[model samples]
Target: MTSDQLVAAPETALPTLRGAVAGLPSYVPGRRGTGADIAALASNESHYDPLPAAVAAVAEAAGRMNRYPDMAAVELRERLARHLGVTAEEVAVGPGSVGVLQQIITGLCDAGDEVVFAWRSFEAYPILVELAGARPVRVPLDDSEGHDLEAMAAAVTDRTKVLLLCTPNNPTGVPISHGRLEAFLQSVRSDILVVIDEAYVEYADAGSGPDSLALYRRYPNVCILRTFSKAYGLAGLRVGYAITTAAIADGLRRTALPFAVSALAQKAAIASLDAGEEMEARVSAVKQERARMAAELAAQGWTLQPSQGNFLWIRADDALLARLVDAFDHAGILVRAYPGDGVRITVADPASNNRVLRLLEAHAA
Candidate 1:
């Protein structure tokens, strides 16, 4: 074997990780492209440029980079609390929605505890659970490509400490209805933490998704996770937060890394909230594009689920998917595809959206 070849270290040489991270699947982000014309639709990021207010806030805060941010994120949390009609103590801000989720898992779980969530939802669920030294129990999606809530409720056992529900679920882009969610919560144990992950809520229609704040009010265990990264075009700044009961929020904050939310991120997020009207206009544009793409794809004899998020899903089999992926790759457009699953194309500018439609049209030909 060469010097670089793998060899097990002697017991005395060094310690190894308990879970041995080698087993964990890597989280693949949306692919990026170097070509100026290449549309980046793989990540569910907003295609719009950052809002003027957010840009100004970031620029102003950039000057204060020399100092550490307020570790507790006092002003940001207070502002979010007022906006969301919750107490400051009920909010926990972190690096991103995923980071805040890590803090949540750490706060709620002990070693070998179980965390249940739908399979093929957010890819991070299992990774975060395992990192917390807990087990991830995956309940697969139903035939409609939506969460099998009844099955999920059945999967719960005494060891289950956390249950995640992703509205406008990642990859598939389906939202769980408010009535369905309320019923599911009623069936589950009160102590089990039900996380309502609304990362794409801004894009979802008013009728489709759960009224999470009302859910949180009725069910104390229900926590709402929201992010500035999606609709606000602040993905680069990485600001996300959790709204929950004061007790749970306190635990989440305790496990967070100090100064994880930078001054720049806090400023940008506050500005994004203040510029809600501008953000709404941008989101409306994305929705219109999504509708147009969905209609055109259907017209081309393609089948896709009704999506409420900022992406379109085509559940292609592996063979066709491979061909489609190659076409997109050669065409210099980036889109997210899961082997043996489907493809998710973010609704972007007309140029990018047209690229996707043309690629599909070529495949059809």
Candidate 2:
């Protein structure tokens, strides 16, 4: 056809996204605040500044940005191995625990394979699973807002490849106890990979959650995922890791995006691990704040599940949720709102926490 005729004709079909990608729900991040007075209690990020050593390390590593990062993340892996008492061969470092989890899913899951997890846990769980062309099976949380391990165990089929257990689960902030998790592990098939995501472990009180390392030692199928973003104050840098068997860890490394962890992030993570004591002190402060807030909220006649994470979960129906969302927005405070579930307010500094308290006090029954 002539150029004019071809131009008049319809263009060829444009490239389209895969069905899985096209149908996937976008992960909604917490709303960021612009005003100085706005309290950012949306994301469960540490309200404190990065550890001094981490900051220093990032600054020092800035000069080396010209070179690509260690693709294998050797130093960071070795450091993390030492920290977790695992061999370097059994450690894999990625951009964040979420990133490592993506690697895990992509490495293990084939098309149509299944991954089981608790609903209202991490929002990323199903997203990652679907992106890997795997089916996501969600087991609803129990009455206490913790994982329904029995249901999760029962959800598994021969096609099931992975199970994600988020301790002190996000949004809800309820933890899976050691005994329950152990029993659940005993019930599941040994061939399936079980990932225990502990992004908020630093904020959890001792004995409140699973001893993941011990569980890993007992079950080769166990994988422990963690991040430096929360309590270590390295959220901006984007570094996290996983502890798994040597073969599986190696496979995850292969699946990781090349140089995904920047040199700055690697240095910051190493330095943060080195400053463990200082990080622990900060975590202790957050825990204290969390307890104080919980106690005050209880006294206010708002019964709540004991949150093991660094945030508080207020379970609300649609009407109450709308009121709290509006009030928090009007008061220059940002928090995470799950439409059908509840609102999660990060336990920030005393002032910010007080703002949340004042807002909730007005709405409490």
Q: Of the candidates shown, which would achieve the greatest lDDT relative to the real structure?
A: 2
Which residue pairs does candidate 2 place in steric collision?
A: none
| Worst window of 10 by summed lDDT in candidate 1 | 13-22
Which regions of candidate 1 are displaced past 4 Å? Answer: 1-12
TM-score of every prediction relative to native: 0.95, 0.97
Error of 2 at 165 (Å): 0.3
Model 2 per-residue lDDT at 135: 96
lDDT of each: 0.92, 0.93
Q: In candidate 2, what are the lDDT values of residues 1-365, reduced to their tens digit?
A: 77767665458767899999999999999999989999999999899988999889989999989999999999998988888899999999899899999999999999999999999889999999999999999999999999998889889999999999999899888999999999999998999999999999989889999999999999999999999899999898889999999999999999999999999999999999899999999889999999999999999999799999999999999999999999999999999999999999999999999988888899889
Q: How far is candidate 1 from the true structure (C-alpha RMSD, Å)?
A: 4.7
The positional error of residue 215 in candidate 2, measured at the CA in angstroms, is 0.8
